[model samples]
Target: MKTIQLFFLILIIVSCSSNKKISVNTSKQSLKNQQLIIDTDINTENIIVEEISANTEIRLKKDSITTVNSYITAPVFDSILKPKHDSFNKLLSMFVSKEGFVHYKDLKKRQLDLQKYIFYLGENLPTQNWTKSDILAFWINTYNALTIDLILRHYPVKSIKDIKNPWQQRHWKLGDKWYNLDEIEHQILRKMDEPRLHFAIVCASISCPKLLNEAYTAENLEQQLTNATQDFLSDSTKNSISKDKVELSKIFNWFNADFTKNGSLIDFLNLYSPIEISKTASKSFKDYNWDLNE
Candidate 1:
């Protein structure tokens, strides 16, 4: 019986030792697994932060480029010209006849008002900061105002050419300098490279584009120009068109290069012409009337 008791005690001791070893190994493996999970979570958090930062930087760079582009391409203008243009508009509505004729005699009676309008234009000539449309509208109004002033100064003149060096003479003052009609038309307006301008300017002659009844305001310049082009083209006396041929104003012949710069003259005309002139259609210039539009 004593021998049996010693063997049983030995077996219990061995069993307790094996259980302790298994418990220690399990605790070590659980700690390692927890550390590995924590390491993976930290790496994922860092990747998310990096991706967000990269996307933000790309957005900021795109915004900066858009701002620079806007500054470069956007047009700027003077606000002061609008009210002065309003005054000119009043005078134009009052004195300009329905057929686009200027009553020089009537305008001469209100010379102070006319001179005041012209003086405003001369003093406030457009600066380089002004938009291309603004500059074009200003010069168109200026050219017409100066023409009327010329006619009023020499009332009853048969033709603009009757006046000595009418276009060449630089008697008019504008923006602290003297300029002639030719300078305004050729040196400034034509150089702007807008072919539609040919239909907006007038020479106070029957053959020239009809002087607009209202002043050309910067706000409505594009629409006004489009209207002028359509009106001029629609005038059968100025431009006669048929299935086989198109007879255009002498103005087109004079400024063929301007109209043909972007495309063929026929293509340009087809934009506004009611009659669809074929590509191979014949073209001719109408006889220009030199008499006063009045």
Candidate 2:
């Protein structure tokens, strides 16, 4: 009887010990699992966002994006849809002559409309659902429109360079962030690996590629970029080309690397230039005209 009682006591103690060990090990494993997840901070303050100031009169089109500037931070509006360029196109067609010179005087007179559109851009930032073309068109339009807005704000300025630090000044904000032209052009657009952007994005200068009379859209972006590049290279004043010798715009000198990515600069020019340049063509750069395109 005594031996049987002792055996039962030993079994109970061993079973309790096994259960305690398993519980402790499981607790440690759960603690280790919890530690696996790491939390980090995203620094959006340093990211880029550009547009005009918030005082524009906004009349959001039905079923379009909301206007959220300084006045309206988290505005509630209809579901945001794909961006439409109709209004901007109308504005461009009205103010931009066929030759690409803008009537800044008339445009300034209707500054509210331009300002409204610019703020609309600030509010309707790109989304992941947007295609690559969508994003490209957005920035190109944004850059050009912002340049115009800058000029209109300081109307009667003879040159884009007249504005102190035209490309670097942060004039407006999107949400809590403010970005400049440098950020949009160099950081965003140029980094997209499209060299033709040099021709599509006008600098509000005569020597820069002529501004298109219509806004760039995603569906026709490819063709528009090609057309812009071709037109720029074909203009004798901008890029004088012969079979063996080429005198290019200083734009070529400044952004030569962009054109040379696939091959030599001549190789890029050939793709757009009407004339086939010789492999060993002598090259020179013309003086850039920085006078306002107005």
Instruction: Give the winner by TM-score.
Output: 2
User: Which residue pairs does candidate 2 place in steric collision?
Assistant: none
lDDT of each: 0.80, 0.82
Cα lDDT of candidate 2 equals: 0.82
* True-vs-predicted CA distance for residue 112, candidate 2, Å: 1.2
Q: Which 10-residue window of candidate 1 scores lowest in summed lDDT?
A: 68-77
- For residues 1-294, what per-residue lDDT tens digits would candidate 2 score against the true structure? 999999999999999999999999999998877665422112222221222122222323222234444433332221243467777889999999877999999999988888788777876776555678988998999898888989998999999999999998898564346878889999999999999888989889999999999999999999999999999999998989999999999988998889898999988888989999998999999998999998
Model 2 misplaced regions, further than 4 Å: 1-81
53-73 in candidate 1: lDDT tens per residue? 554344333422222222122
